[model samples]
Target: MKPLVAIVGRPNVGKSTFFNRMIGERVAIVEDMPGTTRDRLYGDTDWNGREFTLIDTGGLELGSGIPVGQVGLTGQPGDLMDHVMSQAQLAIEEADVIIFMVDARSGITAADDEVADLLRRSTKPVVVAANKADNAERRLDVVEFYGLGLGEPTDISSIQGTGTGDLLDRIVEALPPASEMEEEEDENIPRIAIVGRPNVGKSSLLNAVLGFKRSIVSNVPGTTRDAIDTEVEFGEQKIKLIDTAGIRRRGRIGVGVEKYSVLRSTRAIERCDVALLLIDASEGLAAQDTHIAGIIHEMGKGVIVIVNKWDIAQEQIRAEREGIYPDPDDEIQSAESYRKALMGALKFIPYAPIIFASAKTGYHIKSILETALKISDMRYLRVPTSRLNEVVQEAVRRHHPAAVTAMKPLRVYYATQTRVNPPTFVFFVNDPRSVHFSYERYLENRLREAFSFYGTGIRIFFRARSSKEER
Candidate 1:
């Protein structure tokens, strides 16, 4: 799990501006978690080699005119201001390290003092950042923050990108050691995650696959509040299945355990080797379903689309078999027809194989296991350098890359597999920019053809040939 870093301060304190620069500079993990209402406030970043998630307290504003001692993080929030402060306490409670932002020009205010008191009471590691310290005069004013008693403030200009690097260095040092939070997992076993929208039969599907009631099935949405990990033996193989809470639409934390449940669902995707994406067969696919699939593809995880509640879908199909509503598009009324439309809807992840199954009756339950095992093998499949280069050279010979400029066309000298587990391949090319997006897709298709990577998303990278290699 990545360490959680909270950037806390009063509103207009440059927290959002600072957050954007950190992630926009490519110094962060750019893969987004869809449907998060706090998307802007939450960002995944890394300094040196240590990656951590940044939680911006931009929305946690303490309204003006409130006295220092009157404000409190206790009890449930009443008004909008109290609601925002309640969220601030949420960040404070979950963060492994805190980055307290302050304005150098304004000096310390009552809000800043209250925030400092909140941090001091928690006793967590705090790194003070004095924003707007662009000039020598403002830099001198940074000392006023030291009086807040957090520590010596790091002077920075979030807009100009001055002193942010040193501030990042301090933030990295203050983070808890990486090993302390690492949860060990068995590499030999194939870890699978059952994920989809709420009430889509994710828990029920897990129970069907296990041939027993493992997760509590319910009609209510967002029933499971946390990730449930269970290890069991299927046939001769031992595998781990992670059942997570349902993710609500629009990133809204409405009722009970909203934040914790959503966090668990996203974290489950991060740790899984293969994701079993369940979709409702009766309602077909929706926008939220595709959003979840997009996140899975972006993470480069092996995925198998399970159309849950097919039994219910069959009942609906039976009613419409006589062409009650004639439609040319959906001419055939069978699984084959539904599959064609399903593939069209999920054209982005065309590589993922879809399985139509019912969680109630245990239909096609064995095939799910078989396909998952096959995908696990495909994710870790490696091709030898000689065979890879031969395939690449043949692919280029068949259809040469289009010329981006009149002077130089794209030329690939050699290619090799650099990593496995969603296998990544690196190609030494004459010019990386000359390779277009469509050409990359063509290459990926050819590689999939040669290697038969059915359900796993593979990675391909192109880099300029080194001068030494050119010689």
Candidate 2:
């Protein structure tokens, strides 16, 4: 269990910069403009041997703070500042410790003073950070924040990495001790990560499932820069829906934070129980989708193929109609053929169950949840050693491994299930190199056929047996 510390303040107050600095990574998108970070981005941080999760929230404006009883912040009628204030108020309620960041270079603005007044009423411990104090001149400006009455302002530069240690130390001290509620213990909770290229409705699907606008959905690509987790109980099952950054192909990623985001997404797949590999139904799958699916397969995580924006897809199909398909069933068959073609484009993830969904319209969203639960169940399946051996023998008998270099035939001595989650199997063979990739695929297919391990990725390892060990 780790304490939850939320970084809160007005827009462009260097909150995202401070968050990225505290996490020791560029988990949040740092932009010069305000209102860039619309949703709360969660990342883990360790300070003084105490680990905690940090949440970077949208900036708060003045006077629009929602009352405590509402689900979240309600926008005020008057101006933009009011909406920002309401969001900040909502952030205060969610945080265990609030790191109220302000710009020292700009000195204190009226919005800062208004947010400070709101923080004064919060029961949570607050650490006022005067960011962008990179030099001695700005350090004097840091003193001006004391007028807010929240105590001393810790001057630090988030970009230059100056004086952040003291700020983190103060933050750790202010954070409540880690508790059991923060720790996740449920093995049955299906961790489904929603992943896709940018602006493909990954966040929208998450929001639809939660039945609220949980993650920030914008028309802009790359709006979501960090992975966000939200738990929802869907149809008698508890699922942890993870929305990850839209991943681009390795070569296409420019340098800096965008590249780091792709790396983070790879790590997210490794940690997740199942990956909801989302693709734009209207645009269809691309080379990047195959690359992402390959990562999921390599990690041996269960996968569910989510084709988002299906409503748009239907309209597109209707526009493309020709005299070739006169009947409705024929049109459906044509659409199914088109889907199969898309699946062919993403052939790397052959085992994943594909579902058509519109995250915006909430079309077939329930099926997505059902598919995730099925995949999670499949990942945890355990086949008995005896059953596995029988399947292996039958498979080998049906299709033997090809002979290596025309010298000797590859013989599989025995096979056993090595792990349950993701269902890994190890086969002892006469020569590991002699066992070809096609043969491994054959064995996996056979195992799936025998045990019904559908919607789960399977891994197979071949170990060469020494002469002495064989004897």
Candidate 3:
């Protein structure tokens, strides 16, 4: 588990600005007006080599300041103070580390001193950041905050990006290392990531597989704001499924927490073994779906296309069967046409296996898990040199590559598998430029046909043969 750091202080003390600066992005809304931040904004921040989640909360006050006639409130009773104490008390309990922010220009207020006294009783580590110290005059004003009894203040101008690195180093020093966190692990577990646009039944799929409510499911879009990871054993294999927030196009991503969600989803894709690209079968494919497939291809990870809401598709097919249909071969052609259309939407990920299922009813859900494991296994497959050469020869015979100028019969001297996990092959050729994309695709197809490397993408590299003296 990542360390949790909570930023707490009185209103208008620049807590949100400090939060946005710490995460290296504009995750929190920073407004000059007080009471602007009402909800909690969460984001990930890495300091030095340690990563921690930062939670920004609204400003706290010791009391509601309700008039005596307003809510029949008496004087400053202990009960009224207890209510305000509970709010700050809750933040201290949840935080692994606390950052008490105060405005250097404004100096310390009665509210700031009240909260300081409360935090002094808690054992949580606290760092006091003096915000808006943009000039030497303001820097000198930070000295007055030492009386709050939270140690010397670390001055920062969050809006101008000043002094944050030094503050981060101090924050990292307060956090515990990863080894002390006791993260659970299983051997050779396949890490599967369910990724798609907003409200595409990703959480529903996770709930169906777990046979319980592992994640909160709702009809609302972008309900999931963080990447929630859970593990389960399917058959003999242990799988770690990471359900990430819905990803939006870069231009459409609004500022604040929504933008941070997109960043988290991108990070999740980079760390997974196989990405299950979920698409709504009812809505078919969209431009955003194609964009996501492009990211997966560029990452060189294995992919599986899951067309969810299959129950709805089957109902539509049943209604269509009642009408006058064409010949059997025409029907087969139509099926192939529809398949090609879906494949065209994900053209960048041509090797991915597409499965139709309904995450709601658990329809074909088992097969989806099985396919992910098989694809992960295939991604790590290594081909023998003798078999690789045979496939190369067959590919050359079918569609020979054009010869480079001044080179005699551009020959491929040998082919060998250089690496697995997205299985890369290197071809030592007499003329590397002679190998065209068409011939390369032909060679890949032949290799796939010879060796059942389905559901896995292959990469090929061509290098010119060394001269006789150099060899």
Give the Cα RMSD of candidate 2: 9.9
For each candidate, the alpha-carbon lDDT, in order, equals 0.80, 0.78, 0.78
Candidate 1 residues 279-302, lDDT tens each?
A: 998888888888888889988899
lDDT by residue for model 2 over 230-330, one digit each (tens)? 88888677888788888986545532235446645765686689899888988877888888888888778888888889889777777777524356686
Residue range with the least summed lDDT across 10 consecutive positions in model 2: 62-71
Q: Which is the leading candidate under lDDT?
A: 1
- Using all chains and alpha carbons, the TM-scores for the candidates as numbered come to 0.81, 0.61, 0.61
Q: Model 3 — which ten-residue stretch has the worst lDDT?
A: 61-70
> Evaluated with TM-score, which candidate comes out highest?
1
CA deviation > 4 Å runs, candidate 1: 25-41, 61-85, 102-124, 130-149, 152-155, 160-163, 179-183, 210-217, 248-264, 320-333
Candidate 3 collision pairs: none
The residue-by-residue lDDT of candidate 3 on 267-325, one tens digit each, is 67866788988998778888898988888887778889998987776567656888554
Residue runs of model 3 more than 4 Å from their true location after superposition? 1-103, 108-127, 146-151, 158-162, 178-184, 211-217, 222-230, 248-271, 294-300, 316-338, 382-471
